[model samples]
Target: MSNTMRILGAPNLYLQGPGAIERIADIVANLGKCALLVADPTVERMLTPQLTKLLTSVGVAFASAPLVGEVTPANVARLAGDHRADVVIAAGGGKGIDAGKAVSRAMSARLVTLPTAASNDGPTSRIFIFYDDDHKLLSAERVPRNPDAVIVDTQILAGAPRHLLVSGIGDALVKRYEAAQCVGAGRPNMFGGRATLAAVSLANVCEQVLREHAVDALAVAGSGKPDESFEKVIEACILLAGLGFEGSGLSIAHAMTRGLSALPATAEALHGRQVAYALLVQFVLENRSAAFMADQFAFYAAVGLPTSLAELGLPKPSADDLRTISSLTHKAPHTRNFERPLSEDELTEAMLQLEQMRQHSAG
Candidate 1:
């Protein structure tokens, strides 16, 4: 038997429900004396007053920082700006939360993420992604540990745009397949340790939850109301998917993001939408059965996820374009987490096959 060590990375505390943001003061007080809250402009406008009142009630000294534009080292440093708080509260969408993670790392402060939208699973994981000004992915780095807490206020999430919720479902749906591939290949997780059973379980459950509740949740999303299905999908997107990917690692589905981001045609697409299309490429690479592919395509259609290259804004990519994407994808480390080594030629060929499959499905 192989004796590889297994590890699971997760936040210290996870709270999810309607109005969970109200408990932020008590949670912050438990973690540290003072707090630094980081938020994007929209969230700052909507929530700053409410959060300030809560923290003030508990006498938790706190300051606010605006998370603007992309997350870069310089931007994060500017936001941190000599503020020395013991705890950092990252509140808003994914970018806002990511800004908080960067600031917390810069200041060596504890982190508490209060995500307003379930756009992606960055909140509960230690990984913080950085991007260039053009919005291409620069790097993904981890803090010394995961956040002290991840607070998901479903009321806030439900009030977000329906498209954001759909993007999150698209992101969460791929975790099970990615985790299975990584574990089957005996790959080290993001923590550089073997995958634990808990990680695998969470990955499987994440996908199951998404498949079961995503459609129902989408119906209620953006209505400014929370329901059972919406709540479950939110947890799957923010918590289970976060732990699953960080603990079991990513594969071709995530690796392709590097290539997709490099192209202007797809560069500005939402991260989860990119992943959704890339997942179709992954299925082609894996040579999944036609029946399985058909079922997944049906699901994508129902959820309004992009199914064709044209839908992703690349209507007629040149051969050189395919080569550029394949070359960059081949260079990504996680691309090797598949069942076998993937050549650039194979990557390009898989994309072409995916296009053909899309045509056939449409026909």
Candidate 2:
């Protein structure tokens, strides 16, 4: 399979800080003349005037396509077909950015992503996830390349809901764990090549940033101020984690979370939140030491991540529920990415063990 090759992928340009959004007009102009902006309703309402002024000053004609619903293939297809523009800018939260990625791909337009919330790695990855009309995850579509640019205005991120940042930390926390597994096994990354030294290093850095700064960043993020810790955490969560996961690889942690979709009861849980708890299950599957598990458990609890299914709104998962989730994990393509075989029984046992630990930690 030519697994010896090394590969890395990333957005063309990444801009951050308080005034980054103000530069979007020039950035968009450099890429294309006329742009179509697909933004969440909230972004359209809150930032349109400033965005409009910037674009006008730069003489970049732009049109707005407000995102009215969840990111689904049908919705993205519709947007791509309906909007004829030189470039597509997905502005706002994860859904809007994902829609922008898909729509840009469908239309063959240059892509730009402006994320208002530091909630996940989707903002910069070459992958965009879509859900079915029923809100079930449909697929993770890989674009030909990453976004042309990813603009993260920490001013906006600072004002975002604190949970979003915490969830981002949850998502970023797994990068080193998963990447280390992939590297140790000589497994191929998302692009079907071995992880490069650079990719592995980025994953390690992402984990280090989260370990050191996430909690303090969460504290200042609530006040809506762009502090140093907030900037570092945002970079780790969005940029570094994006590069790390996509360029290194996803392992059991993500596979387990993806499996949670099989349960209708977990439909309301956030993606990052699900991954946070699933990491504990991975620890069990890997037979990590109790000291290591306890350290991770404490980190999750301090960051407000879901440490138990109860927090995920499924406090009492029946045996059937556990079996279903475990089976789903076994069926996931990512589960196979692990060096060792992953079984449904192991998943079930790990989940139960996670719950027991949660109880013990509580006591």
Candidate 3:
């Protein structure tokens, strides 16, 4: 076989520490003189005053905007048109960060991401998953390149809800397995190129670090303390997982997430929480050994990740709901990356199988 071309993409700069956000002035200065800070309502109330004071002290002119809802194209367009700034700093969770990325692209302005939570690996990625008003997955928009910079502050993350950290673990834990599946399937990554050795290796490291330190990280983070384990696991969850998934590829777990968005039952669930349960379904879809599944379920339980449909708020999902999820997943673009094409029937069977194993696994 001919050698496959490999590609990798990453932010121009990445800084992570307990009080990294304190360096906001310096980071923004390097990008431009004027900055537009974007955040959701909650994060805006939490961080805007602090960020504004810091930027003001450094003499950087800046404007602040609050994203009211989902990161839709219309919102991005509004952001690009409403405020004129040299750079855009997206702060908060995934949606806020994604909105900033999209706005920066539309304006052709420089981009910086300051993630307040390790919810998902969205900070360092060039891809943005957009949704409709009802939170249905509409499309995934890819920037021409990754952000100019990504700054993650563990002190901020430590104070976040414990559910967020646990959800991040669920998302990060699947990178290794999904990357391996992509390689086995000979699929192109998000960059539309073959998986690089670096990407796959990082995915391995991501899995190892999470398996070893996730519990410790969760414990300290829940206590509102930034410990070494939180630092390590957050890096694994955000940076490594971001790089690995973008440079390696996506598979069943992520495709299933696209489907989960279709159901109102899962609307309240966080992205990683839904992905957590989807990973078990991915395991079932692969027909993985019972021992492997048990170990995974144990790890999920230890960290309070979602493993059963009940955990995802679908204790008894209707047959119609199951069919809808399966149909959406089957039709998702990412499903084509699987080594074997997954049929809707296969997806339904996997979901059913995972459901059947719930009692047995708990027992």
- The local distance difference test score of each candidate is 0.89, 0.85, 0.88
Better of 1 and 3 by TM-score: 1
Q: What are the clashing pairs of model 2?
A: none
Tens-place lDDT per residue, model 1, 1-363, is 163989898999999999999999999999888898888888877877887899888988878888778898888988888677989999887798899999999999999999988999999998888998788889988788999999999988999999998888888888999999999998889988999999999999999988888899999999989999998999899888999999998999899988999999988778889899989999998889999999999999988898876888899989998998899999999998889998999999999999999999888
- Mind giving the per-residue lDDT tens digits that candidate 3 earns over 98-131? 8888888887888899998899999999998888
Rank the models by lDDT, top first: 1, 3, 2
Q: What is the TM-score of each candidate against the true structure?
A: 0.98, 0.97, 0.97
Clash totals in order: 0, 0, 0
Best by lDDT: 1
Tens-digit lDDT track of model 2 for 1-363:
456889998899999998789889889999988888887788877777877788878888877887778788778778878879878888877788888888888878899999988888888888888887656777778778889999998988999899888888888889898898777777789989988889889999999998899888998885778889889999999999999999999888888766686677786777888888787787888898889988888888888998888888897999999998898888877787676897789889889998998889779
